[model samples]
Target: MSKIALFGPTALELFGHTVHAPLQRRAITSERAAEFTPSKRVLDHVHSTFPFLSRPAHITVFDRKHRRQKYARCHLGTPALLNFDFLHVGDGILAPPPEVALVQAMRGRSVIQAAAQGSALCASYSLHADSPTIIQREPIATRASLEMVTRSCSSIPGCKTVRNALPWILPHAASPREIALGLVLFLPVRLGGYGLPRPTLNFPIPTGKHPGNLADRRYYVADLCWPHAHLIVEYDSDAFHLTSDQHYHDIVKRTTLESMGYHVITVSRRQLNDPSEMDKVAACIAKALQKEWRFRVRDFPTRQTQLWTILGLAPNR
Candidate 1:
């Protein structure tokens, strides 16, 4: 059986399981510290194998039974590290897989917090992943691995939020802002989301520039596109888009796309500061959808949250 250890930021970083978005960690209070020491045998094994972790910070491991011991105190009910893909961190000693560590790292937190962390993990490899601090060196979780982790999260209680948020976490989101934009638009209004259909990310459209000339052919990659809705949304970063040359090019690109019958909407960081502003943003998209095609919004999937049921949350409640 895989050995379970004390889960914390140091262990996660050592295992390379950081996220692009920020989430809360369960603070280790003095009371929790008594149960937080690593087994001498496990400590020796880890030190012998991965000495770098020892230098940066002290390591901790606890008997798996300690998980049940703190059913009420730890609240997260022992870090969920079962059947995890152990990484061979040199020597024979193994570390928890990045995906598993992510789940464990957010243990004892609310569903939204956990899902936000998971969303950051899901978006890590997307074209727009974001982290204010150092760049992560470990590989992000793949779709398959993410799906596996989502399923496994059900084994823990109060994880419905994480499962519910999975469908909204797109792997193609170019950045955290873009993900925020899409979620703002696609998530149900009741959840403080726009309640619209999911939009495509980094959608590629042929620009028809030198089409036959393979070398000179060009394409306009829309940040968020809904082909059927004929709507495109872009989150503009001043640092990236304010240059004179870039501004001129953007005008030409938008003109070309508009001429092709695509309605483009550009949003800035300032605009997304609050719910009222985001509501106005969604209104703009809704108005465009109505004016362009006269198509009605599809019936919202009320049961879009069956995964919550899988996670032992009541569907009716």
Candidate 2:
């Protein structure tokens, strides 16, 4: 049996040799080692088992100059090597020529930066690997809902006239209603009076009379015309509801909107698991519509205007 004698000056080297020698010899040729150091397969195995290694790591090894000079000159804080493997392409090697080591370190830093940015982007868009490219491409419930809404809208008694007249009438309607219609029509899921199994409604109501007033506005604006009749739906998650301030703010906003005639309906994190929440929300909306229209026809009043003011409007007044 041929035995290999692997020697290193430090504990890290000794450990590396003991753990990596076999895999390095098997995967990489001695000739290849002359040009570029071979990566140990064992490192790949370890990284796969511990996915956390994808995180940034700062490592320093003694320079080859110190190794050759027999400790004649020792430098502190000067890295001999910096090993980083963001792609998990085996254990990285950065030896000699501080410039090379610096370059490798920067590359590693860039990988971490890119990863953090990618994570932020994915989180912001609620992107998922399994999401469909198009509404019709989605699973049965989603496809059915969209088809039903489109078919129903097209088949309405005077749909063509309504669609043709929409461009003109839309501009005259309240900004909130216009925004709500746009959001519903363009949303990934079907919404608005759609008699589908699971329907969602979104309100993209406008805020502020001027740009400056837009700052720090409420999360949502309600349509006061049919306050209790209109449902304000929210998609909640641990991330959004994490802080006490956030929770309190949401509560206050919901209460204010409710006071103005809107019925705020919250969808819990777990409720999204069952598709029936869609139908439940829709039913609640239908029932609310049966009540009297509380929103004033003339114009939406300020917060100080009581509901009584609208109710007292005389037929000719």
Candidate 3:
């Protein structure tokens, strides 16, 4: 078992697929390649159980040549060595840290796709570490991580778009819908989203001047909040917020938010799912924002975006 560091999609899937699953199989092994070698029994067992694994395991040697690459060095963080016979190609191999693997996987993808994937990954798991790649780690650092992947992306030949989209990905998103709402609101209007100012997810705002102690305080946690704009957007999914009690609570919450001088906007699954309807909804949001927005944040145009603009990524607003 020669230790090696595996990365890319396979590593991301391996590291995160079962982070909280009941049957976690990932295990730590020898820190150095010279210290470990797979036994015959281990190899046989892995071969036998390979078919039943959630995903096929693939491993590769992390050679010195790779370490010199800028992206490789910037993206690859602390790696953990593991033993799973199927993942071993020839001998001792290790895997890149989860963050490293994710950045490696983002290579060659479109900006929209990469941003969506990165933000979704953030929502699904914690990817932050004290590693140099990330600064000011998010609260959910226990769930997913972030690092200099954005900077690394910028240095890559075709990753300018990915680099520009980096600021849009949020580590605080709690669900896929929330991530989508962020994309729809921050992605340039040409991309079919509203191009509104980026907002905070699951933002808590106090309802009263002194909302009791922290434990007893009343808060209206908006799905998305633009505090400066004094606006909140709530994705009212039928599956979760359609109950009578939830509905009543929502009515009261909206009233309270309005009383607090915050404009409340409710979005539904139906409108988000349809292009024409989504556009209308976005228009309504634009109107609201126009009324209150003293300043707005739009995607900063990058070289890739300038080229995209010329190529018709979206018409100038």
**Segments in model 3 whose C-alpha atoms lie over 4 Å from true places:** 1-6, 14-54, 63-95, 124-161, 209-217, 239-241, 291-317
lDDT of 1 by residue, 170-261 (tens): 55655556666666676554444566777887899887754232322278888889999889997885636488877777777787787777
lDDT against the true structure, each candidate: 0.54, 0.29, 0.52
Candidate 3, 158-191: lDDT as tens digits: 3455455566676567665677767766766445
Clashes of 1: 3
lDDT of 1: 0.54
- Select the stronger candidate by lDDT from 1 and 3: 1
Reference-based TM-score, model 2: 0.27
lDDT of 3 at 220: 72
lDDT of 2 by residue, 165-260 (tens): 222111111222222222222222211212212122334443324433422364564322232345555545344646887877666666655554
Q: Per-prediction count of colliding residue pairs? A: 3, 2, 23
Model 3 residue 188 lDDT score: 63
lDDT of 2: 0.29
Flag clash pairs in model 2: 225-295, 227-261
Better of 2 and 3 by lDDT: 3
